[model samples]
Target: AQSVTQLDSHVSVSEGTPVLLRCNYSSSYSPSLFWYVQHPNKGLQLLLKYTSAATLVKGINGFEAEFKKSETSFHLTKPSAHMSDAAEYFCVVSDPRASGSARQLTFGSGTQLTVLP
Candidate 1:
């Protein structure tokens, strides 16, 4: 079985400070990890993906994450938070090799991020 845990249900940060949101996962096979950001009433956008090919992955809007096998964690980080960055984030896990179309993705509950002035 595969599962993802978002450590925080909400995170608040100043406009210019660093941003950090934690996530951990457990998977039976080599899993494909992804981070997606969703603005209010908007669709989800792919931030990054770790496909067991690279440990350090970079994504859109200056976001990045490292895949840690020992810790079973893939934490999102950004050097400086922007007002536009305020949105809901999600950590997802899926076996790319699973039977079914590649479009099938399992999403985490979510973590709401607030960027304060």
Candidate 2:
């Protein structure tokens, strides 16, 4: 079984301030973790993924996250916020053991980020 929880339903920030979105996960297997960003009326884009290789992962749009096994958390962080960053973010988890024909992605409800002008 694989599941993810997003700590925040919404986040608001100024145009130049930092951005942070929290996520937690639990999986029966090692688990593949991912952070996806979705612009308004657009499909989700892969930001980064953790395949049990590295704990620290860097993603596009100046976003990054650290995988903490002890804490079971993968939190997204950005040094600065931009107006273009305003969108919905989803935390996803997948299990390779469950990746054959029955493969499916478990997504967090999502976090709506609002970048202030």
Candidate 3:
């Protein structure tokens, strides 16, 4: 079984400042981790993913995350925040081997990012 935990339920940041969203995971086996962002009523978009290639993973919209197995963490960060970046973010875990009725993806509760002008 695998699970994802987003440390912050909400995070507020001023425009042009750095942004950070913390996340952790627990999995019995190696898992694929991802960060997804939902802008208001828009659908979720893939931000970044880690599948054991590089520890540091970069994504669209200037966002990035580093997978740290020792810390069990995959924290998302951006050097600067934008008004358009205000949205709800989700951390997800997936077992590539799972299939056919078996549970695959586990999503974190979610973290709402508020960008203040």
Candidate 4:
């Protein structure tokens, strides 16, 4: 099983600058990682996922993350911040041993991105 922790609870950035959201994870086996975004009062959307295939994963709206197994880190980043990017982001890991009763995703605390004009 694996679990994730988002290092930052909130990140404020100017609209034209870069954005970085840090995440760290621990797992007994190799785990599938994901980044999901949730706008206020809206459903969550998948940003990117790492399924033991690629080290670097690119997502919509110029976001990306690199999976570093040795470091146990999968951090999300973007070249620029936009107002639309202001949302809550979750770092998630798939629990490999999930059964009928167990939940599927182990989620991070979440990073709230605030884009300022």
> Of the candidates shown, which would achieve the greatest TM-score relative to the real structure?
2
Task: Determine the C-alpha RMSD for candidate 4 after optimal superposition of all C-alphas.
Answer: 1.7
**By descending TM-score, how would the candidates be arranged?**
2, 1, 3, 4
Give the C-alpha lDDT of model 4: 0.93
Model 3 weakest 10-residue run by lDDT = 96-105
- Give the distance in Å from residue 106's predicted Cα in candidate 3 to where it truly belongs: 0.6
Per-residue lDDT of model 4, residues 1-117, tens digit only:
577989999999999999999999999888889999999999989999998888999998899999998899999999999999999999999855566587488899999999999
The C-alpha RMSD in Å for every predicted model, in order, reads 1.3, 1.0, 1.4, 1.7
User: What residue pairs are clashing in model 3?
Assistant: none
- lDDT tens digits, residues 1-117, model 2? 789999999999999999999999999778889999999889999999998888999999899999998899999999999999999999999987774888788999999999999
At residue 28, candidate 4 shows an lDDT of: 88
For candidate 2, list the clashing residue pairs, or say none: none
Model 3 Cα lDDT, one tens digit per residue, 18-59: 999999999988788999999877998999999888999999
State each candidate's clash count: 0, 0, 0, 0
Q: What's each prediction's TM-score?
A: 0.94, 0.95, 0.94, 0.92
Q: Can you give the lDDT of residue 112 in candidate 2?
A: 98
